[model samples]
Target chain A: MNHLLEVNNLEINFKTYGGEVKAVRDVSFHVDKGEVVAIVGESGSGKSVTVQSIMGLIPTPPGVIKGGSIKFQGKELLRASKREMRKVKGSKIGMIFQDPMTSLNPTMIVGKQIAEGLITHQKLSKQEAKKKAIEMIKQVGIPNPEERYNQFPHEFSGGMRQRVMIAIALACNPELLIADEPTTALDVTIQAQVLELMKKLQKDTQTAIILITHDLGVVAETAQRVMVMYGGIMVESATVFDLFENPKHPYTWGLLNSIPNLEGTEKKQLIPIEGSPPDLFSPPKGCPFAPRCKYAMDICLEEMPGDYQIDESHSARCWLNDSRAPKVEMPFTLEKEKTVTVGGESID
Target chain B: MTKNLVEVQSLKKYFKIKSDVTVKSVDDISFYIRKGETFGLVGESGSGKSTLGKTLVGIQAASDGDIIYNGQNIKQLNKEMKRNVNKEMQIIFQDPHASLNPRMRVGDIIAEGIDAYKLFSGKDRTNRIYELLERVGLSPQHAKRYPHEFSGGQRQRIGIARALAVEPKFIVADEPISALDVSIQAQVINLLEDLKVSEDLTYLFIAHDLGMVKHISDRIGVMYLGKMMELSNSDDMFTNPLHPYTQALLSAIPKTNPRDAKRERIVLAGDPPSPTNPPSGCRFRTRCPHAMEVCALQEPQWKEVEKEHWTACHLY
Candidate 1:
């Protein structure tokens, strides 16, 4: 796999009334060509901020990327000029936001809006852009594409509006797609359809996708690799199989345990992480998650743990991963075992 | 004789658009909730789940049918009886940011119901407010702070505290945790469960997420555009769904386990038909992969396929 995009030592801060909010702190990751990597995190985990920085779309004054190197196709993005960034924004790297209603122009016709990208990026004529716009709409699985093309954003439903947004993003055939919680607003069925559409599009176009979402289910289904973020940093990174089967970080375990299973099994108690996310204004001196982490040691409070390698592709940032720390079992797995043993005894 | 906490018979809520057109938000839906049980309502956007919730809480008046609350038809109740019924039924809205009053302190917002009924006076009311705040996992000092001072999850807890202040027997949690983060979502769900037991509360938990619904609900109801598609116990619904729509919905829930990555997914085609001009007969027929000719020609009857398991489909 060839590297398509690489973000190294990324740091972002938002100047708030309270203080300087360290939104994204020393985050690093990379996406390979034709590969899907999911950045999984809660609201303030900096997953969205990292992606926004990559797109050079983060607002200034209030928002600032303190230090980072974002390289796309061997070209540095942080140092890129405004004109250069604009040319690369939609044409080279397409983005789909969570709310399609806000992203789309309320007054503009859907087709004309899509055609604008093609006209600017591909240098297509008015007639060509219109024709391509209709074709793109049809490709995204919107029924009666011609009719939908002329309708306004308000005319479409939530799911249909999302498809329109997808059509616009994929119009110029960008090599990379950065989808920020694209299907969060849609229902489960519609989300399934949109995800399926994205997988199919990737197969045909060979576009590398960086899917940023808090949904582990989405990550398991669509992404090959996963990066679990906490306190504005990547706590754990691994292949989908490894992450689910042999998760290392305590935060990852908490996330997996918090979600209710949908396999028609008896409901198990969800082990929610205690306390809320750390305040970004003055982040913890050591580990950001130490306050909520059950396995916190004395060192965990005073010093941060670096990424300890588990294998060639899997790594986690936790004191438990350190050789000096005592071995500890994952909480959910232990709870499951206890239940299983009790059930076995009851059967006897 | 079995007593139902709340019962609905052929409920309909229609919104008029201009002079001719009308949006059939909730059209001819009937169901009942047993005491101390969470009834889950799941659907896509514009499926009328919120409309059903609003109508039940009397925020939106039903255009037709009856709402029997504690053995009295709510629509037919006198002004005095209606005021009394309001004390038993309350709602926790989806957006806590918008639901809570910006001008009032947390204490006043939670005491609004108490004050309306003159349930308590000056010092006693303050004591009750502080107790309610602590019950929902908030600090007693939080009562003095405004809504803006609280986080999204904290604000939702305040919403719960306000609902509990009146000692409501039934609460409508209309996507209460959807706006929260995933980790915070679990906390809210657990808090709701804890309160349900301590307060002896019955909830109409309306949300689109199937996993979260199954966790908190004893029974689940799936709705399509302005119509109920399926209803059954939560376990039975997931294990053996009869309706095609229900099965598709269950299948669409992305499995968290990576080993289940190869799980067969049923991706429904096209968006749900508009409620204003829903398809003739079954509303789900337009998007149903198993759609037959009769599905378009005639509406399916709501049938009890098995004991306490109901579905609306021609195949069943």
Candidate 2:
């Protein structure tokens, strides 16, 4: 596989008033060329911090990438000079955020935000940039992109503003696009629209996408491979089918159980994963999910299990995967799990 | 099956933009919540779910509507009667952090309703507040702390306690869990369910998450641009959604698969037209994938396709 981006032992820390807050710890994942990878986790699970570290968006005084290696197309990002980092930031890597209201300048027109990146990088003239901006917006499914070009962010609906955000991110035609919960705040219908737009754009442009979200439904629709994170650690990483159908990790099972499938015939009361996400302040001793995992063993609490490889492309961190550990299948909550596994295709 | 706890009839809220183009925030939307039942209203931002919420709670005046709480129109109530009706109707806002006052302690915030009604003594106030805190999964002692000290989930719990303080019969919960984490969203929802049953409460739960809405509601109402696009039993809505908007919405939810993430998606083209200058006929006609020439010129009548399953779409 041709990897577009790769990270190794990415450890990020924040210097707080009390002490150093370990945001991300020994996290590693790779995105392949033209592939869509989802980094799924709840808030404070280091999903955001890891990506911020990627774009060098985190404020260094309080936040620091203590130790890590970020390589994009075989070029080291952390080791790159300021000039080199600038070339890579918008030229090769694009990013869209959760809140478009904040991501976009309220005073500026939507077209300008998109054109800024193009003009800055491609050095296009005002007329050329405007034309491309409208085209990009139209491609993202924003209605009447030319008229909407002059409209401010507030003038657009939540779904439309998100579309604008996508247009701006793809303005420079980067190889990789990192969207942090692009649709979390949107309504289901609007969220669906944005997700569809993203998928279509990716198909048309063959742009690799890194989607970071807590919603498992999003993971199922938009990711080719998923990296399930908890407490700054990758709990599981596998192909979408492999992860959902033959889910190895107990945490993944917990997530699967928690997903409220609207399309299904049964309205099974979601057996939510008990307990809160592990606190980042005083980090847990071993596996962060051990407290919430239904199949936690003595080894899980005392010593975190090493990687258990399912296949060349699939891996998980859980003691239950060990051959010596007890074999216990966690009960699934889906009504028609047998029939609904394979054709559990896209809802939209 | 039972007498309605809250009745909304032709509820319309319109604002006069400086240009005389009326921005219909809630345009002729009507629904009723039965006693002790949860009526879930689902919609996108600008779909006016929150506007309907505020109108029902009497926080925002309805331009043309009758909000009959109990047996009286709240708008027509006398000053004293209005106060009494207001006391029985409470709302839990989307952002709990902003909804709650920072300076006030949690106990006082919760007890404000109790205090307003002059129902509890100073000595009993603490106990009542304590009871509410514990009921919402917070420690009784946490009442002494400020809102800022609580996490997003905990803050929402505090907000719930505050609403339940007066023992309101009907609660308008507007996107209460949308701001919380997914894992915690379920917890808060479960807590709300428990509270509704234990207290014999009627709830108007408004949210954008169809799954969560279906999980807790007896009936779900799908809204688009201030109109009730579809209304049906929770089970039926998911099983056989009739409205084009509803079907598209149901389909649009990103499936939880990582491998097929980049598949061909049906993204609706264009932004929703401005409400002030809404397109003729159907509000959703401009963005409807199945929209027709008739759709642009004439609005569809809201009719029942099956027993108790009502949808507003030309095709339906």
Candidate 3:
């Protein structure tokens, strides 16, 4: 399948007052046309930075994309000139940011914000954009679209503001959308509604999605393919089922175990991985996860592991998956993943 | 009943937007937390989950309710009584970064609560502070450092340590782990659990993350637009969600397992209605997937839908 957007060997760094922070390092992934791809990791795992780089939204004064290519529809976005890239930004690739409150202009009426994007990208007339903006408000399921059009961003709820943001992004009907933890700030029920709306819109627009979120549960629901990041490195990449059912990376296993599961609610105590992410200012010499990984080998501490192929589609960067190393038991959830399937279909 | 540690009865916290209209933030919601049990309050952003927690802890005075802690109404607490009660009922704020005093040393911040209750002398307080620091898995030496010195998880631990300094019998942990990294959230939660066991403390653990909240809470209360929509044991709430909202919330929780096909997701029509200008009666009626005319006009009476399981939806 031809990819709508492809990121190859992406590297990003932030010039902090203290020093340079290597936020994203040598990461690569692709989103097929109309496909929903999830970039999953804990905070500081460079998930957000990777997607932000794709849109050229990362500020250069501090955030600098040092290397790699971001190609959208075979167009080299990373190397594209400022004037040339501006044409593609909203018209071809729209972005819905993480926090709607901060993302939307506070003073401007929500409808006008949507209108501005359409006018800027498509050169829609004010009259045409106004009618189109109201139509968009309806499309995203906002109640009283006319009244809402006159109200500021603050007038809308957290979820509604997000909808308005989505409406703005989709008003131009961009071929691709980059949502960076779009619903993380929302409540669970509201998050569900927004996510459902996004998925539904994807069905209609067929816009390829780069959904960035740390929450594993959201990843499971939304993504067809999953890219797991740890300490600026893409540790694993696979289909959601393959990654969950047969996790090979020790970091991924730790992540699975750490999640508070409904099935395991009976257990009184939860097993928590001790320690923290290595400081980006000065990362460790080898595998970033080795310090906390229970299955960490001596070699893991000394050198980075090569990507180990689990299947044709699934690959994990872990020493434990090295055939030379001894095998380890799977996390309790993955053990269940071996059998569980949607629609009650048995898979082994 | 072994004398419930905290009893909230008919809690009606309504904000008077104007002379005529009122936003019912926590209307007629009631629950009790017994000694040494974790009771989780679960809901979305506008669900009044946080308001209910704040009311129980007296962070905000209830509009029309009784927060009876050990036979004393928290709303009626005098200056001295309020000061005394403050020790046994501390709140863990949602944003650890915003909650802590940036200018002051962390040691001073923790000790401020201790000094308020006057649990120990100057020397004893210093020693107690160090012990509390280590209890939350922070270095005792970190006491000298400012709030910015520690990571997000560590800063939250400082907040937890401050809450413990007063040696509170009950704590209202208001989304304590939401702002943390997934890698560090478990550690903080486990620390809270450990402290709960050691201190024999009751907790009103409020969060949007049902999965994380379920792990610690024995019984869970589901709130929506300032009302207790559903209340049940952790097992029952997950296994047999009564209210439509609860069912929707459960289905929404992203499970990592791939073979599990997404359930028929209850996509509520619109966002949660605003509290200030809430819909006529049943607040959830606007976005409720199974809403009816009766739901629009009449507020659903809270009742025991099943044995030990409570729900406030007409559909039940």
Q: Candidate 3 residues A53-143, lDDT tens each?
A: 7777889889888999988888898888899889988888889888999988898888899999888888889999999999999999987
TM-score of chain B of each: 0.98, 0.95, 0.95
Misplaced by over 4 Å in model 1 are A334-348
Model 2: per-residue lDDT, tens digit, A154-267? 888888888888888898989999999998878676777787778879998899999998888878877888888888888899987787878888778767866676655665
Model 2 chain A — which ten-residue stretch has the worst lDDT?
A: A339-348
Q: Candidate 1 residues A151-269, lDDT tens each?
A: 99999988889999989999999989999999998888889999999999999999999998988999999999999999998999999998988899989988987888776466776
Query: Per-residue lDDT for B1-316 in model 1, tens only?
Result: 6468999899999999869879998988989999999999999899999999999999989999999999999978899999889889999999999999999999999999999999998999999999999899888899889999889999999999999999999999999999998889999999999899999999999998889999999999998888898999999999999999999998998989887878777888877777778899788888888999999999999889999998999998
Locate the minimum summed-lDDT window of 10 residues in model 2 chain B: B256-265
Q: Which stretches of candidate 3 lie over 4 Å from their true place?
A: A123-131, A144-151, A335-348, B17-21, B73-82
**Per-candidate TM-score, chain A:** 0.95, 0.93, 0.93
C-alpha lDDT (0 to 100) for residue B151 of candidate 3: 87
Q: Put the candidates in TM-score order, highest first.
A: 1, 3, 2
Q: Which scores higher on TM-score, 1 or 3?
A: 1
Candidate 1 lDDT at B2 equals: 47
lDDT of 1 at A117: 96
Instruction: Look at candidate 1 and tell me the lDDT of residue A166.
Output: 89
Q: In candidate 3, which residue pairs clash?
A: A217-B254, A341-B259, A342-B259, A342-B261
Give per-residue CA lDDT, model 3, range B46-124, as digits (tens).
6788888887777888878788898888778798898778668889999999999999999999998877666787789
